[model samples]
Target chain A: MIHVDGLTKYYHDLCAVDQISFAIQKGEILGLLGPNGAGKTTILRILAGFLQPTAGTIRVKDYSIDAHFLEIKKLLGYLPESAPLYHDMLVYDYLDYVANIREIDKRQKLPRIRRLADLCGINSVMHQPIGELSKGYKQRVGLAHAMMNDPEILVLDEPTSGLDPNQIVEIREIIKKIGQEKTVILSTHILSEAEATCDRIVIINRGKIVADDRTANLKQTLSDKSRIDLTLQNADFASLQQKLGTINGVDRLTPIEETDHHLRVSISCQGGVDPRAAIYRQIKSTDWILLEFHQETQTLENIFRELTKES
Target chain B: MRQVLPIFRKEFRAYFVTPIAYIVISIFLLVTGWFFFTTFFLFNQANLRNFFGLLPIIFSFVIPAITMRLIAEELNVGTYETLLTLPVTFLDVVLGKFLACWGFIAAMLIPTAAYAFTVAMLGQIDWGPVAGGYIGALLLGAAFSAVGLLASALTRNQIIAFIIGVAICFSLTLIDKMLFFLPRYLLGIFAYLGADFHFENIAKGVIDSRDVLYFVSVSFIGLYGAHLALQAKK
Candidate 1:
């Protein structure tokens, strides 16, 4: 439902968002994962029509952002990072004001608000001053504000930042629920949150999209090198390296650590092959006692670290 | 116009939600009341000319205080993004906020009618000039509040907005006073542009379209400047 093309945003001499393009299908939950200063927020802001792009165009449902901004904005609901709120107003009053501004019908405002409050788990704190509420409740109120119009596209920037683990889980679950009916785009530095919440993950770094695919696919494609860790007793470093070096799938072997009684080594295997059985046969032929031999699969966290960490 | 109503409602009620509207209105009444009463006894006049006369100066400060937080606070709290990203036009937001602040000033002026009533009871009072003076005060407040809104839109700092609002309003009001230092050719222009130049006729119960147009033009320029500032941010 949203197509961004060559979007570039510059703040004076500094480029906040480089020329980047991506499309989000309707009812898809897309997570923008990036480290700090990765231009994730900048991209989200442009998509929400808050900031004009220095170059290129954003189109929602075939309407361009510059020409049909009001129409596009009507369909977009944005919750900025940190959930900036009016501290003086009560939660109910704030959401009501947002709903009014969103131009919801007067007859439906109360019902819509109640429904959103229940969905966001903020029904009990409706009458409390937003300033008096905890951070989690405040964020829930912000979510209700963003969803006031029942927008077709919801753009949230760091919706779970600064919340506790339980609050994070609650918000993730709420976003997951909302994602069932709406096109949701959220940005976060937390990889687990993105994996848990988003169907497709767009990993951004230095204002560029380095990886964009289905969450599972990204993990599968980026993690190509499998590792086998071995701990052995009464085995010399040279013998262990010489024996494991000639194995068919072992690409690289390096001793991790060694002591008088024990030695630890890791085998970098190629082509997703498990060389544990071959190594086990080799260790059985010798008198050296094998303490541990385990094969490790690549994790999503490893893929994230490999792609985003600075070379 | 319909979209502006929500912003107006929110902003207008926002004042009362905090102690700001009450405090500002109370201070305004107390200060203006003191000036009106003391000038009444000193000048021994049955007219409200002195009370109306001090408004240009009184409102130069008061209106800024009311309007300084309108846009600046929204920017500081990051609600500006949410508001602008909505379906409303920039004009709607500006007009709604301008009207709300102006409406508060109008509401605050409602109590000052008692000054006129007291003067009428104490002595012979002409209602025409009193009515005209109140109209002039409203227009003056509108003009100052517009300038204040423009300043508020220019910055995210409320104090800076207040200072800029006061500086612009004060300078415009006193522009005519610089006529002695200006060349003779610029005298008429300066006089015409002075914030209170058109207000004198209105205060004296002489309502000219020229004076009305002058206040409207100044207010239009201020509101338009505010609108442009909003666009520049994007």
Candidate 2:
């Protein structure tokens, strides 16, 4: 369990993280979604005991970050952005060193390292120097380093940044597997990563929390802001708008583009009701050909853009 | 304290694993060997006095080179963040790294024992001053390494850390030679401050507690300064 209150961090004149407060329950995978410079990494760093906040406090399992950070540190396994590990050391040596520092039992150290190597998929490159490995391999080594102690909480800052798409998926799968038991807090600018992996999402912008809710519930709550896109073969805009205007939930119909053979239009709708059925019934009585008609619920990507719009 | 050993072992092994340790040791042996043996026949002395004499100035540069990358490289590569987030404390890091650098200085000194051996083979050698000289060398190495670690912790740039470390260690070694230029009344304080002055006293086979305390205190001040510098970043 983690509790953060008024966690503020300032880099001299500029504020990195404002008075942000959030709590995470045990075994919850909380995704911190934010654009660049949105204080997502700052919040995670403060929680990991890497940086001291300018103001406010963080507590884990009743132990305060200010006074009991060493204990909290023992509870956390942190992977910094891009996984900056010792470049000169061999991967096996690096993990062995981490295991030793974490005070893993002398006898259990090798077996534990083997298990983590298996979990992170880094056994093949175990003998290679970390600098010689690619970004994906370096990140896996960083993961093994973080999980060496098997800490209860894992804080990853942009774990998938600079990786290939396949690497991203692999890292996400690893994170999802870890999320089954441990408390995992990860920050990412990628919207879909949050949607696919996190149980709950906290959307932050300009050092402020804009939205915080369950991933499913967030999209469900904004489902009322839906749109029905239509591609009509023969209907003209004036008559089609006139005919669809009578539907109760449909707010407005706007023409998108007109081709020689088809007329494309987007109908804006409000309320939680599905206006697709009524619109289809209205079209069923008419002679217009329905080439394409699909209602798209507001996705997390759209909601993210709405909350943290471009400046 | 318990966590210090792992960090120390890692840092120590890291030096040997990378080419830095070999390069530093080779250069140290070359410079000391060339300078010490070149004057060997001219002085015809059985003692390692010339070798120990060159150490205060030589170590001023050598120890910094040994220690410059200790903290600066970690900061530059961003591994300091990873290391700090572990369960270790600041003291754990500083002590571990300080001991590793000191241990490196000891290891680097091992090859120079051949110089002492060659001297004993050539002529009658007084083992007392030779023993004292080696002891003084270790103490001086520790003090300089501590100062270098402080400089390394002060900046994320290894070159700047090396330069700052060399500056402080060189000043400590050179201060005694400039004592005549100072006002008569402040002479004692400046003389006492010169690192070379205490190191020479110990190298004379006189293990005075004051001289021993001087190196120990200098090392303490340097390590403590490094600890404060790291804390100030937070």
Candidate 3:
């Protein structure tokens, strides 16, 4: 539904977004994962029409960001980072204003606001001033503002930041529900949140795309290498390495931690190898007491860190 | 154009959501009221000429104070992003805000009509200039509001916006009065540039198209400047 090509943005002489490009399909929950100052917010801002790109074009269907921004804006609902809404207006009044601006039918305005308030779970704070609401409530209100128009595309920047675990879960659920039919593009540094909600994840670092794939595929690629942790009691590192190091696929074994009578060592193997069975048999023949034996599970969090980590 | 109404309503009502609206209106009334009555009894005049004569200078300060927050506050609070991401265009935002400031200025002028009523009750006051003065006041308010909005758009700091707005509006109001400082050759041009000069011409009850065109042109120029400043922000 959306195509971004060579999108570049510069603030004076400093480059905020380099030559970056990506395409998002309709009904796909796309998550942009990056650390601070990684141009994630800048990218989202340019997509939302809040900032003009220094170069390149973004096309939504037949409308282009340059020539038909208003039409593109009509199809987009954007919530800026931290939800900087007008604080003085009451939540109800603010939503009403947004409804009016969205040009909803006069008869359907109140019902629409009510439905959004319920979806965002901000019904209780409707009469209170937005400035007085808690951070989580304010975030819910921001979500409502973004979805007020029920636009085809929703762009949210760090939608779940600064919320409690339950609130984060609620927001994730809301995003998931919205993602069932609408296209969503949310940016965040939180790996688990992205893993939980995004169907396709794009990892960006230093204003560049480092990785882009489905959630499971990102973890599947980590299978080429694996590590096993073994805690051996009464066995010294010299003998453990001398025996485990000679295993067919074992690359290296390093002592992780040592106690008076116990030793913990991690062994790394390469090329989709499993040296655990051989190592276990070798330990069985010895008089060493085995305390624990398990292989480390690879998660998307590890891939995210490795992809976006500073050089 | 239809989208301007929502923004206009929100901006107009936001002034009352805080105490600033009441405070600005009260201060405007006190200052103008004080100056008008003090001379009202001294000259024993039944006409509202003195009240209308003092409006442009009084408005030069009060209008800025009212409009200083229009764009500056939104930029400071970062709500400008949310406002722009909507379907509205830059002209819609600028026009909505400009109209809001002008509308507030109209509300401020509403209370001063009592001054005309009292003057009429006291003596034989000519309604011709009185009506002309009000029409001119609305035009002047619109022009000044546009200037204040441009000033507000030029900066993110409300205080700086207020100061810049005051500086420009004050110059426009008093420019004709300072013609003695300029060279003799530039006197005509400077006088014609003075907002007060054009304003007084309409206040004389003539409703001259030249004077009306002057206020309308000022409004257009100021709003256009604000539009350019906003577009440059991105």
Candidate 4:
């Protein structure tokens, strides 16, 4: 569990993390969605006890980050955005060193290291030096280091960044599996990744939390305005637009593309309106052939862009 | 205390994993060996007297080159954040790194014992003075490493760290000799504070507690400064 209240970090005059407050329950995967410089990394650093907050408080499992840092640190695993690693050391040696520093028992450290290496899929490269690994492998090794301690709280800053599509999916699956057991706060600009992995989403814009809710609920709130795309053959574009504008529940109608015999249109409709039926009847009466018509569902990307836009 | 050991082990092991530890020791031994051979055989000296005299001057540059990357490279490579995020306290990290550098310096001094053996074989050796010289060299190395660690903490550029470290060590070594222009009272205090004054006394095979205290105090001060800089980074 993590609680951040009125948390603010200032670098001279610029506020890195403005007065922001959020609480994450046990075993919850909270995605911190934000653009670059949205203070997401700063929030993660403060929670990990690496950066001291200039104002307010952070409580991890009832222990304040400032007052009980050692206890909180022992319970938390932080993977920074850069994945700071000692390049010259071999993968296994580096994790072994981390295990030792985290104070895991000598006898237990090797097995735990092996388990984490396998979990992050870096077992094959265990004997290779970290500097020689590719970016994807390096990222996995960083994740492996974080998981080595088996901390209850995991703070990952851009866990899927710089990975190829396949690696991203693999990391997403690993994060999903890990989230089932630990409290995870992952910050990422990739909206779809967050949508796929997180139970809840927290949208941060310009150092503030703008939206915090269940991912499904956030999508549902934006789903009221339905979108329909219509491609027509042999329809008069001007007259069709005017006639569709007259429909009661229709909010807006805009022609996307047009040719000699075909037209593509996007229609916005209010909640509970089945504009497809009306459009079908109108097109049939006009003697136009309906090539294709489909409703577009609201995606997390669309919602993310809409919410983070300048307001 | 428990956390310090792991950091120490990791840092000490890093020296061997990379070429840094070997390169530093090799260069130092080569240069010091050259000096010993040139002084004893070419100049016809019978003892390692010249070798001990030249060590502080050599360490003034070598120690910084060895220690410049201790913290600076970590910060540059972004590993500082990883270490800081661990449960270890600032003091533990600082002491562990300082000790690692100290350990490397000690290892470097190990091969120089051959020079001591060579001197004993060629002449009537006074073991007490030879022992005193090694003790003095260790203290000097420890002090230089501490100052270098502090300088390393001030920047992410290891080259800049090296330059600053060398500047600090050079100035400390030169300050006492340059104090003749100052008034009597100030010159007296400056001479006592300067490293050369204490190091010279120790090089004469004297185990004066005052000189020992000075090196220990400077080392403590340098390490403390390094700790503060690291804390500010957080």
Clashing pairs in 2: none
Q: How would you encode candidate 1's per-residue C-alpha lDDT over A1-311 as one tens digit per residue?
A: 89989999999989988889999999999999989999999898888888899998999998998899888888988898988888888998888888888878989999999899889999899989888999999889989888889899999999999999999999999999999999999999998899899999998988889889999787776456788899999988998888889888899988999999999998888876667788889989999998888878777677778788997
Best by lDDT: 2
- Name the top DockQ candidate: 4
TM-score of decoy 3:
0.95
Question: How big is the positional error of residue B126 in model 1, measured in Å on the Cα after superposition?
Answer: 0.9
Here, model 3's chain A TM-score works out at: 0.94
Query: Candidate 4 on A231-261: residue-level lDDT in tens?
Result: 9988867888877888877888888999998
| Local lDDT at A56 for model 2 | 97
User: What lDDT is obtained when candidate 4 is compared to the true structure?
Assistant: 0.89
Residue B146 error for model 3, in Å? 0.9
Q: What are the clashing pairs of model 1?
A: none
Mind giving the per-residue lDDT tens digits that candidate 2 earns over A1-311?
Answer: 99999999999999988999999999999999998999998898888888899999999998999999899999999999989999889999999899988999999998999999999999899999999999999999999898988989999999999999999999999999999999999999998899999999999999999999999899787887998899988788999889899888989999999877889999988987678888999888998899999888788988899899977
Considering lDDT, where higher is better, how would the candidates rank from best to worst? 2, 3, 1, 4
User: lDDT values of the candidates?
Assistant: 0.89, 0.93, 0.92, 0.89
Model 1 B-chain TM: 0.97
Off by over 4 Å in 3: A230-239, A254-265, A283-294
Give lDDT tens digits, candidate 3, residues A1-311.
99999999999998888999999999999999999999999999888888899999899989989999999999999999999989899999999999998899999999999999889998889999999999999999999999988999999999999999999999999999999999999999999888899999999888889999998788688776677888989999998888887898899898999888999998877877788789889999999999999998667777777777777
Error of 2 at A41 (Å): 1.1
How much is the lDDT of residue B204 in candidate 2?
92
- Count of clashes, each model: 0, 0, 0, 0
DockQ numbers for every candidate?
A: 0.70, 0.80, 0.82, 0.87
Error of 2 at A252 (Å): 4.0
TM, every model: 0.95, 0.94, 0.95, 0.95
What candidate 2 gets wrong by more than 4 Å, as runs, is A230-246, A253-266, A277-294
| Superposition TM-score, candidate 2 onto the true structure | 0.94
